[model samples]
Target chain A: MGLSHQSIINMQPDVQLVAVCDSTRFVLDMLEKYTGVRVYNNLSKMLQSEDLDAVIIATPSKFHGPMVRECLEHNLHVFCEKPYCLDVTEGERLAELAKQKGLVNQVGYHYRFVGAFQEVKRLLDIGAIGDVAHIKAEAYGPVVLRPSGSSWRNQRSEGGGCLYDYAAHPLNLVNWYFGMPESVGGTVMNKIFSADSEDEIYATLRFGSGLSGQLSVNWSDESYRRMTTKISISGTRGRIYADRQECQVYLRDGGNLPDGYLSGWNVRYTTELTPEVWAYVRGEEYSAQLDYFVQRIKAKEMDNINSFTSALQTDRLMRMLIDDSEREPIAASGDYQPLAKGNSSWWQRLTNAS
Target chain B: MDKVLFGDNQFFGVNHMSEEKARAQSMRFRDTQAMIDVLDMAYEAGIKTFMCTTHERIGEVCDYFRKHADRYPDYRFYPGMPYAHKYANAVTDHGIVGAIKRFLPNDGLMDAVVRGGSAVAKKEIDGIATLLIDAEMKMFEGLSTPVIFLQNVVTDFLLGLGMKDAFRVFADHVKTRYNAEPGFFSMNMPRLLDVLEEVGVENPIICSNINKIGFRMCGGVDLYQQILAQRQFRPVAMSVLASGAIPPREAIEYVCQLPKIESIVFGASSRGNIRQTKALIDEFMAVRQD
Candidate 1:
């Protein structure tokens, strides 16, 4: 992700990549040698040395809180990567700090920029999928087929495994659509491949407005070439299904429809929906989110899509899932014998007859 | 480019329509010989061009073709660069620089590094891009790769980045260094054509999604039709089946009847599917020519 950001930043006309900091000496050495950009191993030293307007944090999930706080303390606008912070309270406090400081803060929930998902948001906003009742958010990929060794990605404390690394995408989208769930239930985090972390997660959530949602995520699915996140919404009048590639909406005859959509089915491809970005790397969304950050900072606009506050909502939802999963199952205390010795008269008579 | 080209997506696990099918195909082709059998079927069906990605397993395929050169003399490969996952995994296992070092052609380590380092120092991306291209091309060595492609992941990325000069860099490098025409695979053919034209790549061969239902066509089906009618470039249609959304005959007919479509690439695991698709494409092309 850092490399992708670097490529996009290099191509942006308004952005000048003055310096880069990484813990890996070899990576920094290569960057300094090839790109001639100043490199640093220590974040504090780099922050103090460089007179920068903003900092883009692409570190692990665990490091986000402190790094973002440090950047905010330096009076720099920050664009931090996703799974904003592992601790919800810490994220809330940081989000408050950014808000109080009037900083142009953004989180790297790049899916918000995908055209198909954006279309879903628009259609839902316009009540195209009239009063969505149930939604299923899913994300699957072949990230950890077999656990070889410990990395930040599969470590519970570092990257938060599939819950953060994979589920965070669709979960963020769900949070974007429906702010936060009122309560969560039946949460399960199963360790399929990784020893320390969960590779698959399932949870049921209920929004304040009585809308229900199910979260399903698996990172060890080898069928997919890459991460594929999808969301399907069922409403009173219609249903909507969306992924990075396209969005398909089905509407009944009763409700108000968008301009191009029909009653039965309407499909919108990402190509037609996505606006051209000046610079692109992994996806248009990546470049678009960065461009939005830069533009918002230049305009001194603090409120933007994928703001720290918005990401805090996702962080809180993840906390809820973890808490729900950790709760003990409600099991009856006493084991029951099949007939309870004296209870089943009819069964006893049948047995005597037999 | 041939009117019908075979793709390698099915061999790898990329179904798009169904995960079950993808898993099945992946399991079926776990043995290299199984994949070789399919390729042999396509070859026997008279499809010579194998447009494929530079996945690590493709090295084994290249070795097979090399060993059986006499059996398939007219075989050709249209190799796409930087298999992406390979580099991504490398970046994870090793650092960025380490990954680059690992993938650089083993023959000229110092020269490639110096070139890459100097290119980075001078802020000239061409040198690094060409070096990586050479690394990806290493696996295709000693094979006939007439048309090399820049995968859509990077092609659309550069397109969105508005780095037109990089397209020229890739084209020039492929032409001058490899003696092969450069091809681009993008989701948005209309937009890519504009960029390639601005970069002075005339009548370039571009591969993109061109299905009847506008499946994966970026600028919509109508805009693509307009571009196909007006643009002076070789359009190679892909994803014409739209991941099995449209009937095979209808999909092939829709794409084949389009103006200026130079080639059609499809992947099928079975010999019957291959023969059927190839026969359909041949039938459509013959009818259209008349």
Candidate 2:
């Protein structure tokens, strides 16, 4: 949305700038300078006075549901930033009401619009990578706290912690790609960056397609910004390597490449968006989300971008991540008991480790 | 010499071997100087060797015993048989199975005989005999003092695969294997003595325990009287205070009333318990008319 906002301003179709609302006045002033739009401390006062087509909510987690609900009730199309609400039930109810009232809604997970990701999806659709195995993506931010070191994110009641804040983005991408995971399990340790939010999270997600993947997200890690996310795939034909920043594909050739050769022998594919995201913003096009909402308003169809079902499924995945991590470690047993049945083999005993 | 003395005639004394307590007390195993204090009290009360029942790392305990070999120059330290539980009960800090392997040198006949559910095969009986002979040679080869085989009778319950009769058969086999130079076997004082007689065993045997909670060694009064008349009886009085008729301070008084009693192995689960029992025994001797 950041780049798209600049693109829309550059398009300049007699679009007179209106008021902008931000929880922080500093960000509001910055947005005013960037877009030449007047800033409003309160959204309700701005909405009451100005004839607005839509209201974009880019506030903290706790306000997302209420802001979206108010926007819908006021008969304005809504564009909500990612992780529409910490509570999926609230997001679901708002979505249902929007559908009933025929309102437009768009959630701000902009990765689905990135051309590289779309290209990967296109390959999967065309069977470039055999069966759709699984897709994995990750994103992280600094310790989940404001500069003041005190905020709603630290309070459990506010629902703005890491499980809901940073992890929710990757989880949303997972849901968007591979449906819902069948059973999720792994450890979540509160290692270095100790807050109400989990400092370190390790999770294994098992999808119905029999493909499983592991994800690790933590603020307590040594590097300030070392984001590691990769999509590993396996099928009848070949595999694709969608690394953290680059896209590369390896194929089985008939005595084509030498054993140790990687540079020339190995086929390589690269994206232009590695250095900056502007190449993605310009060359690759996303449905102008605000325009999509306007189209939804004209067509009398409910926008399902942040629909209740989608958000609830994402929330379930988040709860699973938290649940698996907080479980206790097992210890050694003093005496052995007879196995449940007479399973006298070593393989039977190994199952107990699970 | 009483050819094949019925028991080893050895008294149990303080050996820092109860690893269960050692674990409950962790790296603090010997910290309270508990074993030393118990040894001092038992020594003053004329008790000789204190056999430790379990050990943390038997090698470390053996090392400890070897280092202090000079202090116990006159007394015997009979390390009890070490048997691995198929399922570990509790592990010491050192490691679980490593602790059991460390005490392999001390395992006696009964330790070898008990395997959780498999019946005592002829092979198992032969195995027990071999292990006992090996442990015996290892213990007594250099030392002049005889090393007795210490067997806890309760271990038979753990070998549920074998019935009492199977154990008897295994016992007879062990006796026959070691007939020329019988290894001493300790009993808890209430097993059917007929089995011991049936096997024609004369290896020195000590009934290390007396009957507890009023169950006679042999069933009927006639059988008890008849057996009491036929051969000599020895009792290592245990659980005398269970009825509450006997006080903790009257251990010696409590043992004399029991028929054919020779020695009293007082309850000493703790340092304080051992001290109290030793004091009671000393007090009883002071008042003895003999």
State which candidate has the highest lDDT: 1
Scored by DockQ, the top model is 1
Q: State in Å the error of residue B175, model 1.
A: 9.3
- Tens digits of per-residue lDDT, candidate 1, B24-125, equal 988999889998999999999999999999988999999999999999888999998768886786676455666766765656579787888776556566
Instruction: Report the C-alpha lDDT of model 2 over A309-338, residue by residue, as the tens digit.
Output: 566677778867767776764545786565
Q: What fraction of the correct interface contacts does each predicted structure contain?
A: 0.12, 0.00
> What total of clashing residue pairs does each candidate reach?
3, 16
Q: What is the C-alpha RMSD of each candidate to the true structure, in Å?
A: 6.7, 35.1
Worst 10 residues of 2 chain B by lDDT: B1-10
Worst 10 residues of 1 chain A by lDDT: A335-344
Model 2 residue runs over 4 Å out of place are: A1-16, A25-36, A132-137, A140-148, A152-157, A222-229, A252-309, A327-346, A349-354, B1-290
Candidate 1's TM-score reads 0.74
For model 2, residues B158-268, the per-residue Cα lDDT tens digits are: 121112333344445444543322222222132334434444543334433333322222233234335444554333443344323335655356444445544455434
Computed on C-alphas against the true complex, the DockQ of each candidate is 0.18, 0.00
